[model samples]
Target: MIRKIKLLLLLSVFAIGTAVADEGMWLPSLIHKLNINTMQQMGCELSADDIYSINHSSLKDAIVALDHGSCTAEVVSKDGLLLTNHHCGFGEIQQHSSVEHDYLEDGFWAMSREEELPNPGKTVTFLISVEDVTAKVLENVNDDMTEEERNKAVRKTLDQLTKEAKGDSHYEVYARDFFNSNQYFVFVTETFRDVRLVGAPPQALGKFGGDTDNWMWPRHTNDFSMFRIYCGPDGLPADYSKDNVPYQPKHSLPISLKGVKEGDFAMVFGYPGSTSRYKTSYGIDYTMKVTNTARVEVREKKLDIISEYMASSQKAKIQYASKHARSANYYKNAIGMNEALTKLKVIDQKKALEDEFTAWVNADQARKAKYGEALGLIENYYSDVENDKAREFMTEALLRGPEIFTFAYRVKPMVEMLKDPESNKDRIERYAEFLKIMADDFFKDYDASTDEKVSAALMKIYAQETKPALQPTCYQEIQKKYKGDYEKFAAQMFNKTVFDNKEEYLAFLDNPSPKVLEKDLAFQTAVQIYEKYNEIRNLVDARSDILEKGERLFVAGLMEMQPNKKFYPDANSTMRLTYGKVLDYDPRDGVTYKYYTTTDGYLEKEIPGDYEFNVPARMKELLLAKDFGQYADADGKLHACFITNNDITGGNSGSPVINGKGELIGVAFDGNWEAMSGDLAFEENLQRCINVDIRFVLWVIDVYAGADHLIDEMQIIR
Candidate 1:
């Protein structure tokens, strides 16, 4: 009954007309009631209904969650042409590239519809609608119930709600908990599977600045990619086929030729990934010391090893391009997050908030009864994170550090089934076939020698950095048999393991024997590592309930304590809208940064023959000739990128930066370096969303790349 009442109070709070300017990831469904007025006041010309409406198509229909929120993309043409960041499509591009035809170097442009390449596993999901389901999810859930019982009840209710929401439709339905599980919402979606690669600029432009300029400002990276969605004859989601036609979207964004300017109204709409704005001080400390530390330590070694192999040959570089970039991106992010958190004194801020929360709770007996234990519960659970730290280390340095163990772990089930003589032959055969297919894909990108070095180096780091007691069982053998020399062990393991060789692995799969598998050192090590991994996981999970409950109660108490203040939920890969403006900033006392960058700045950053800053000859020629075509701004300078104060994060990489008039101005790709801690705390004075100017994107397509056919499809508003 208490839980139900609390939820009802939360619903009322949700409708209150309090707005936190430039600091929220507002839900599209609730904007009509919660944020429409403020958004309009800030320069949004569209009504709330025009942004999201189930009765008719709105802007929501034009947006897509790329690969279920790994990134975001927007429909730019009536014929299903989609625009996203180049790095978002890096994997597919890398998959289709080879040494002989280096697409990453020369770039890819589909001159005609028939020339576009299909990506089998890629998908684009359009939201059908979102509805609040908090009351339904909390049904039969009460404060009297134990945490486990409450969870079970909520899960049961969510399952039922999802079923009813998807009744008799092809749409996908799922529910997400917001505000620390105090509120619930159900989303209905249509996922189209036949997404195709349409075009991308070469690395020279798309990823021009590379790691050196990744999270920094004044960025000139093009950072954009193009893909097309294909649908079945009836305009429903379908698998990739030659017969599929371009999807006719309900709405598409009109590209604006009127360029960005300082303080102009801007809005970013997409899925921003996970953020912990309400994380306690203890959680922040653990993230800096354990999570980020482990990632930086392990990935540094792994990246160095991969870089060496990549330098060995072009084939090796192509094979590891996407893998290296993916690992390095977050690896650097973790490092920067820690630096920014410490420099900004985020932990101190959280501690002060907790102190105030405690005072508020103590001042009133009623508040005390509801929230007195929240901080205690949170602090107590986080005080002992030894097992959690070890688990993080194990994940980065062993399980995910080396590719071999994870790939080998896949066959564990099949091996177990093979051990049972009474196991069904058909089931075993089907599993074997699946393993064969897996092996084919794995070996295509696998280089045993490179993996061996990475495995050895990362294992050494794990042994040196982590406590000995938490080491996996295989480490015991390494100490006893190999004298703790990880390199020797890795060498012997790689030489003997059939998992390292595709043909050998295929042969072994053809003839299954448990006895033979038991003798395999890599398989034995993988099983032991996974067992220890599970043990640590269980230990950490055992203590997680207290933290979960504490956070929920704390968030609830905060709402009650401050009834008039507006609050926004943290990012959780759900569609959100954030309104701000195109504005410059002062990074330091002496630095006044500009809001935009031009092609001249792009040229100024060039280092001739350098890997990261080398300009392509054709691009250099175009820039030297000042041939920017219709895409150049009024100043007659070709703008490369710009900055806006719009709030964004990881999954928002390719989100469209829309102007007040509901037109695409740029494609948001990164956030400024000064506010790397923006995810945890909105740095109102410093945080900026970096974007590739739309005019620059068009210039590349119309003049440099000569892909004018692609531009003909867009509805350009000059």
Candidate 2:
């Protein structure tokens, strides 16, 4: 019923000829009713059914959510040759890397099928179908119910709906809320677990310009990697086995050598992680002051410690490579987001919109009765953020900063079983064996000394940034016993804790004792920190509900007040289609940025002996020789990357940029720095999706690495 109203509202907007182009992450399943005309007007050659269909294979079949939506990947060959961003596959690459075979520095390529590296516990999920389940989920819910009761009712229905949707099938079924829980959808998905690494360029090329160039325009990073999917003999999802064969995909994208030019229609289809487009001014203030600030402060210190260890040896570098990149990516984003939010005057704009809503509601008694308390509820939620601020700092500094606490916390259940004298001997033995395996995985990349330093530094910051009452009890112990010397405390804990030494920890696990676990300082500290964190969470739970309810009411009221305006739901890690054109913009006064960058620009940015900007001798030779082969543009230059106005976010990192004819042109990777505030509120003119030209990706794969065998599998169109 709600879906019908939304579609009618959208149709009315088009009927009045007031519908705008672009700037939305629209659902692909509803495009036929809501956006097909607009997309056709924008020069898309394919019909709605060609892009997404349940009865027949379509473009949607080629795209899969990598690792269940951390990133996106597209099949480029019938044999399930998948392409995604290098960073999306960074963790897998780092895991396979070592001092003897540093895949991060030297890159990895499997010349033969037998050489491909299988990734256990990795998966790629394909959407089988999506159905609107809002009516069903909300049937038992009502405005009279408290938020807790409402949630219970909704969860009960969602569980039954998902079970029915997945009945007698191997598919995974889940429900996602949209438009602030005003609507819901159920998705049936197929997940293939046997994913393998095929090839990836070295960090020098894949991550060129590194932190200095990330999220900036004119990007020269190749930023692409290749993988393959394997299936069982019956052609279904299965575990890794030598007997498995390459998956035969229903559809695969055809590569287009006809590079993109400005004004060329383009589209991206992927699972966008999340966006709070309707966030109020108070919420925005909280995000900048508390959320972003805590992340930057905690990570600023964490990255320094990781980098110091990384520089100590190649082994350490490989161990911390993925961890550092993951931390730094968001640390920089938070800084950039704060800057963009302030400079763009987003809070002022939101306040103005709130004022307008207030005026509109006051003009009508009916609206006043429905939405009079919307803004008040939201404001009240943010009225006192002292506890909230402490919570965010605690989360960043203690919960996430040091790896040791969380790693040690994993054995809490095992300790409980040991404490119970009635626990079965076999059950205890099984858990001990499980802990041994976990210890091996944990200690593989962990350096206790590094963690020790991180814990001490972050603990000090947490003490200073948060109020004394919010500090964990462990800090109180430190203050009394260690004379407030966190360094001394950390040193003593590191020396005494069995967790710092894997062999000692495993030996202790062999003959585990409840008394020993109780006396362990690290375990005791972890328990204290987690218990306090939970206390903080409970303190804020009621206030968070206020914000959630206010936002939902505000959105629903706005839709009713403006019946002619078309509204799209915020992203929630579900498949969406956003379309636009290859275009450039002037980021600021008198500075018109170009739509594309070339190999020449890449060389110009090179710095000798610099890790971030150093030029590979082979890459330099090829660039200077102008040996781009067929990948060169009409101007006889090798284009590195291009920009488009298509709306995208984090999880869309490796989505394919398809032209009007549905041929792959580039791989969507980053968003320009000018629009770091885009996740909160999109700035259409400044928000550009940065993509690595498919030609550049191919050039590195075929020419630079001379791995032509991989190229032969793709269907290329000139």
lDDT of each: 0.87, 0.88
Model 1 residue 415 distance off true place after TM-score fit, in angstroms: 1.7
Clashing pairs in 2: none
lDDT, residue 651, model 1: 98
1-718: candidate 2 lDDT, tens digit per residue? 1223233234222101123566888888988987888888888999999999999998999999999999999999988899999999999999999889999889999998999999998899999999987767777887788777888898899999999999999999999987777788899999999999999999999999998998999889999999999999999999999999999999999999989888999999998998887888999999999999999999999999999999998899889988999999999999999999999898998888788889998999987887888889999989989889989998999988999899888778877678674655677888889889888778889999999999999999999998888888989889999999999999987876788889889988898888877878888888888988999888998577888878877877766766766678788899988999999999999999999999999999999878799888988998999988889999999999999999899999999999989999999999989999988988867889999999999999999888899999999998
Q: lDDT of model 2 at residue 716? A: 96
Off by over 4 Å in 1: 1-20, 420-423
**Per-candidate TM vs. native?**
0.97, 0.97
Q: Over 4 Å off in model 2, which ranges?
A: 1-19
